[model samples]
Target: MSPATSRGPKTPVDPNAPGPMLRYQSNLPKLPVPRLELTLQRYLQSVRPLLSDEDYHRTEQAVREFEAPGGLGQQLQQRLVARAKDPKIVNWMEDWWLDQAYMGYRDPVVVYVSYFFAFKEDKFRTVPAKRAAAITTAALEFKRQVVENTLEPEYAKGEPLCMDSYKYMFNNCRIPKKPSDVAGMYDPFKNTHIVAIRKNKFYIVETVHNGQQLSTNELEQQFQQVIDNAGHIPALPIGALTAENRDKWTEDREILLAAHPENKAVLEKIETASFVVCLDDSSPVDRDQLSRACWHGDGRNRFFDKPVQFIVFENGKAGFMGEHSCMDGTATCRLNEFVCDGLNRNKINHGSEQVRSGLPAPQQLQFQVNDKVEKAVAEAEQHFDELIGKYDLTVLAYQAFGKNLIKKFKCSPDAFAQMVIQLGYYKMFGVSRPTYESGQTRKFQRGRTETSRTVSNESVAFVKAMENPRLPNEVKVAAFRAATKSQGAYMSAAVNAHGVDRHLFGLKNCLRPNEPKPALFTDPAFAYSQHWFLSTSQLTSEHFAGYGWGPVVSDGFGVAYMIKNEALQFNVACLKDLVVGGKTYKNAAYHLKQCLEDAANELRDMLIADMPAQAKL
Candidate 1:
């Protein structure tokens, strides 16, 4: 299956429909609130592997008291169900989840909340301008389809996924605010240009010129002009202020606006642009370097709030950085897949080669820098350097085997990958910890994601068996099968919006300020189980060299993986000074990469030795 397309039976629609992207949206079901008993039961099962016997007993007592007949759990459940049935609310958890999970979080988005995708090299376009132009043209075509609402909706399991998040994909920017950020969406019809950053200088590159969209050659000319005009020296790095803490940026923004009247207009031009293209001067030679560059480049030549930014390096290497506030990875993944696939297939229209006469010169966005503004910029740059310097990221492209081999073992590819991560962590730490694998919840209206807890009793058993030298091959194989089965079950529940985490989150949100807190909410196991020591997610594409995000917790590792046909790609990210259990993990990302490779080989070897010959492909 194409990475962009989900598995689903075809649902016929009229060819002449006006809003194909949103046709089924009204008929889509609302996100359901799972039954209280089922949620409690699953919650206990999820935490079983991470708790001791005594801790387990206490958790059991907590669950019992919380779910006792006519208890607080039932009251919270009632409130959640009532909210779900509200006619005005499309999804009961939408507003609260957005606020609590994203907008309300005040960290700098660059290294904390944003994510990146390093594209596979494009052999045909080796020049930076050529590559940037091609990427821009392809992305603009995608924007056109989205703006016209003619893009076909994605499907999973014979049902259409929600297409609502696509609205935030273009001409949108996340604005800094005091309490919570707000998403600003400009009218697509009015935003005819895109912002381009080079040498810490910003330029307005008009995508549409002379009442027509610019051709690939025209875009190349414009990008080249911007590059040439930017000169060799870097500018004041005003964009670095966006990489500061949310509150700091919010304050600095006011100072910037107060510094000059025209500053507002300059900000508006950037905020309202269709998207951003960063023409970076660095040449990244390897996967690690590319991933880092795309993840958070210099942190000065980037406006991190833009929802979509295509970064092109001086060596013609290109990748994409996505803002995580308004949309999830699935939406941006599709957008990127469309761009790369379209370009690779030569399907995108490059337009006429002729550059039209009297084309408007690229407009440089000049910020009025006063003493205060310059000081703010300098501080931002220093802070950005300090913040990014503390994190290390490594990409492991394991070519031993991938989905093709895993399928021969009768395993779900994703489940097998999850086990690989589990075993890798076990090999390093000698125990399983809380692990989170993101599952898409787009089957429901305005859906985003739910946590698929990966560490289970079965997984613990499997990992332990693998670690034990005395374990027989048959026993180890059986344990592996059971672990994958358990992982698949929880993942199914998560994607269906019946997982433990979000349901518990909703129940907690339903609690009144004056109400007594339930023991279940205050349980130590509850907090520990959700700590997510290994934060993992998968978004695969053959065209991607690497993709990842920063860890959610300071001590945890953010593991983003891709399972390709012949290889598995893992991007492990964590703090450089990682300390867990009083022991500092120097070069943790590199250690995890080695563990992953060993685990993959061990699993393959065990299956080959124990499984029946007929099962082998």
Candidate 2:
């Protein structure tokens, strides 16, 4: 079965069971160790296209010498296998990966570690109060399922995936520190309130009263009260400081905390809340507008520490912002899908339309910001405006074809889309370079991700053939098939924890002090190839109008694509100053849009020629 197919849970599950989500948790497989020989072979295949012939020969020699029977590669592989087999270690790479890939890095989270979703507008509920109330009601239902441990586990290809990350879904915050960051999880039972931010003012709204969640009408009433009370009064914009770099923000946080003794209490309340609901004061119409609205409001209006923040606009549109430190996109994607699905299907309780009188009002949380904090907030807001302004986002809702057409030709939709990306980059740059695509390893316990190096010699050949006007359609089609097959094989290997990148990472980290660094690690091609020029991933959902994050490197493009039945959507982002071959990456959105349409059409035409004579006629 393809990785896209979901097999049912490994063990039979009872719908009424209390711990349904955990039924097969203990039985999940441990991450595997790839054979050293197979890894070296895959590594060579992946890196060949990125290097010159001479460099490729040198790298090949380095690999052969490193893989000798008594060499360092052999020794490190043994150590890695032994570590994986250690009785106490659930997954050998989890902690090290979490730190190096996410937390320990010191870039600003807005453009790097944070991701955003642009939600479809609610036509039925045009008022902000009504929309906010309904979304909160639906979100609380999801929280109840997770907190009660009754939510069904997710699966891919009929195999149960790890559910450990869901525990950090609610009531979690990523706290900043000097050299690193740490995550804290508040007990969901104790943190029953949601933090609502509007006009740079914070309010706490209790979801439960008299042993039941607030009715939708009551929640709306509370929201209305907050709007009326806050009354467009401008506060000091303390939340804006969060958009700064970690090291800078850490210092700013201290100043705010020392501004007043009560300021610390306010910070704690926002951090410990179950989740955040930002009632953005603007209305957005299209994908770009909605995405920017949800991505980040005026920096002053957001508290970025919470892992999940639901942003609802005045026009009743909503989306989510995720702090990407403690959890990966898969977990949050599932959470958002569940919440939106509940609302769509009416499975969530809308409660009575009648408002209950005399309920406790939402409490306003205020901080004391002195001159130092005031200046810092101004600087943060300025930086945020300048930073996000540099990013240009465009949505390619390609209506000509989608997964339906790709699957008709017996192709994986994801692999087909990936090829389109490669061809698109080659069209713009006249070269194939290192590309990064995220691969899930969640079949194992606490597994997060493995890099599925997307560039290969087959892919390069395919793109070159497609771009050459002298080539026949048959030749291009053959190259396309070969490239997709190569992609599928590597993806399968990655899902099984046999991919070369992570394995190499583990081996290098375990090297003994006396051992000399392997020549393979020091190769210029190794460094150049790992510097991804195109970082792409696919996470599709019907609930979102658009979703994506900024590029990982300055010169790279963050290409996040979603495949729906009738169309494909892409959210392409990059830095303002990024340029390649004298063309600015800022203009890549337009170029990519044209390239995707062209590639899809060109491939469709080629496939049509392969049909039987009668069918074609």
Candidate 3:
């Protein structure tokens, strides 16, 4: 097992345990710095598949020169290692990375940064009001657990992940600024209401009154009131202004707040609310519909700043939207799983109190808009619609087999699925190029993710062999094993913070103002390989019907997949289908589904053929 996956020391489960969330915080090892030579060597290996032989040779020479003793690369690596060892730096890369890769990135969050998850079908609460009520109650329950720090920490293979991200999962908002952005977390007790958006209008529904949480019935009634109050008349879509670029939104927000000082207080109330509940008018069925609904609805129906937004659709279908600044998918996935599972199993405390006569009715937040604000909202709506419309989304729920079958074949499920991705990409584009797979690095304090380079020579060979009709079954099976093994090794290295990308990134980050740019980074192959033709990540849960994000690049595909016991679900996204050099990326989801099914069947046949007759039978 990789250091990232190593099981934590077994401890007895005690409900009365003190600070269980922080039990392993002090002793957990700090993130490590790999040797510069290893990182350079791996860098060369990763880039070779994406470049011409001549270009690869030039890049390899550049890497060697960079790795020489007393070189700039050496100096930078040393600086990074020293930073890691600094007594005050909890995690060396956290601040720089969060700012550069996320906060400082001045893009629209809708089709760029935010992620979404479609919840599993809820059978009991078919009525939209009941579903919203139950969901709100469940969320409050989870919120209480989070506030009290009573929720059990999530584990992977029985190993505890850093639960630090959970602190930002509630009562948090991403505030826009001129050059960069900032996040704020408020006291959970003070944020006692949930913001509800309907027909582009905002409503504040108080969750706690008289020191008691409102019952599910009360919540349902409030939700119904909001819906009824929002009838057919559309209000100014001030929320859509948030879907603009951070810099742009910052300017517009200033204009908005200046229009009416009261708007400032309203904005804070929405941002500092415990969470948001978006009662969308659209009722969607199926994975694709639900994903599209949750991913980026009319944009008017969302406050993109809130970390967690539970989207309850008109048909009672629900999902979640996450602001990427505060936390990642895994952290929010745990929260979603808790909410959905608790509601489904009837494990949440649905308070028994009826609607008291003295409780205030839900209050609608009003925004005063002038011509400038009106134009800004229109522009934002147009951008949101066009950007989301240009992209295609499809969900591939392959129920034929899943991780159980892969394990029965004695292979790592993730590695096997990665090969499936490789084969699928090759089948579509006729080449195996640079690929990115996110490996979680939450084993360390404040750690996020490291890039695992998935495209290697072994993967290429496997894809070629799989595509060659004349190749023997045994030969193909051997190639498959080699490819999966290589993938597994790279993933382990990534999780251990020994991957090439972050180290190189750190080195680049450490360069002095007067220092010349490193030849290794300036090389053409460096940019080409990191272009990331296939940006992929996996967060598997039976509770999620679909989950995904936008592609990192315009020409690439963002493939987010979930591995279940009996099925594999993929949410493939890309910009408009393009035909470049007679290679098309249209209907990528369908093609990937076909390729995965084909590869799995071929692997099963080859493994069965290699087994002895009795064992096979």
For residues 170-214, could you state the per-residue lDDT of candidate 1 as single tens digits? 999999998998999999999989999999999999898768999
Backbone clashes in each candidate structure, one number apiece?
1, 6, 0
Question: On residues 458-483, what C-alpha lDDT tens digit does candidate 2 reach at each position?
Answer: 99999999989998878988999999
lDDT of each: 0.93, 0.84, 0.84
Candidate 2 Cα RMSD after full superposition onto the native fold (Å): 2.5
Which candidate model has the greater lDDT, 1 or 3?
A: 1
**lDDT value, candidate 3, whole model:** 0.84
Screening candidate 2 with a backbone cut-off below 3 angstroms (N, C-alpha, C), the clashing residue pairs are 5-157, 6-157, 6-158, 7-157, 7-158, 8-158
TM-score of each: 0.98, 0.95, 0.95
Q: What digit string (tens of lDDT, one per residue) describes model 3 on residues 483-516?
A: 9999999999898888998888888999989999
Ten-residue region with minimum lDDT total, candidate 3? 1-10
